[model samples]
Target: MLFTPTVIKNLLKKPATRLYPFTVREPFPNYRGELYIDIDACIFCGTCARKCPSQCIEVDKEQGLWSCDPHACVYCGICRDTCPTKCLHMKDVHRKPMTERIMMVEKGEPPKPKKKAAEAAPKAEAEPKADDADKGESKKADAKKK
Candidate 1:
């Protein structure tokens, strides 16, 4: 019969799919699986939040908080790529299946106020003191000469 030969050939071959749960396939190199943050390196600049296509990331600079709604994330890696501190990273393995929705929140030290501007302010204020000293010395020299 026409069907008999085809069915016999299919049955003779091994199953096309593997036992998924029992035998997981290794992920390819550079696979963007799960997104995680290195809280220590994060500056909380909101760059990642701004670059996220899904807008799942939330950054609180004052509070030093970085939170992401994994459920809303598309895992596009834009956030990771745009992070200034290179704190964002992607794991090769996917996130484990979750029954309940949860927010991925990280707490870190807030960015310290830049001291360069503050240091420059004091230097500018000090320069006038030097000029005043030079003026005083010149006045003393003129008086002594007279």
Candidate 2:
């Protein structure tokens, strides 16, 4: 063990590896790093969650929550690529080491439901048309055509 080349190299030469915690390394260009979502820009679509191969993303449109499990994410960048609103982005930096898994959740306003035809019809019938002159002209034209 004393004669080992590794021991001799360690003693003679500088360390090949840097102290990671002390020396931070910058990520390369086009690197598919951790996921980052712009919650304000997001439209609460489940497209990102559906596109993720790891299935780490969870989108709830009704409650308006977009969550991602960092522990389970493989950093594949599929979610970012497939986001319709272009809110999801792949950042160069990654999340720091954590003891426990944490799901990142962003809450937003829920989407408004569309008005049904039955409900809309009553509202239209209740309001009186203001342009009586235009209506009379249309009726006169219809009578002439008949």
Candidate 3:
């Protein structure tokens, strides 16, 4: 008799869970869901690759390529946090289900090589002023006399 009443009460109560696929819940604010990169801003410094615990990120500075294996990624946001250029970002929504494996690759312009000190030194030496030249000659003449 007691069990009958309990069962009746439970049966009359609404379900505890929602229809998940039909009614998706909104993601929480600042949720790290999906990883993405702004290729233009990336410096290919390999900081992200080095910091990734899963080792899913790959960077080629010479080729200016940044690639990530989403299947191997843990979505922990470590790569995003370590990026020097602030190019890495995470969206609020998670990545969609995929039927096949795919690589996330981004190509950008490589950083230009820095000028060598040896190349710069000659430029400075070639630009002597007339007054400076006269001073140098006078100094040499005085040294010869001494």
* Model 3, span 74-135: residue lDDT tens: 99998888787789999999999999999999999967545676577545634543444466
lDDT of 1 by residue, 1-146 (tens): 87999899989999879999999988987999899999999987778866777768878766789999999999899988888889999999889999998999999998765687765754774576467547657966997999
The Cα local distance difference test for each model comes to: 0.83, 0.76, 0.82
Q: How big is the positional error of residue 83 in model 3, measured in Å on the Cα after superposition?
A: 1.3
Residue-pair clashes per candidate, as listed?
0, 0, 0
Superior by TM-score: candidate 1 or candidate 2: 1
lDDT of 2 by residue, 1-146 (tens): 76798888889998789898899778887887777888888887678766777767777665779999888899988888788889998878877789986889989875654676656754563343224335546866997999
Cα-based TM-score, every candidate: 0.71, 0.64, 0.70
Best by TM-score: 1
lDDT of 3 at 91: 95
lDDT of 1 at 121: 58
In candidate 2, list every pair of residues with a backbone clash. none
TM-score of 2: 0.64
Please name the candidate that would achieve the greatest lDDT relative to the true structure.
Answer: 1
Off by over 4 Å in 2: 1-16, 116-146
Point out the worst 10-residue segment of candidate 3 by lDDT.
Answer: 124-133
Please report, as a residue range, the 10-residue window in candidate 1 with the lowest summed lDDT: 124-133
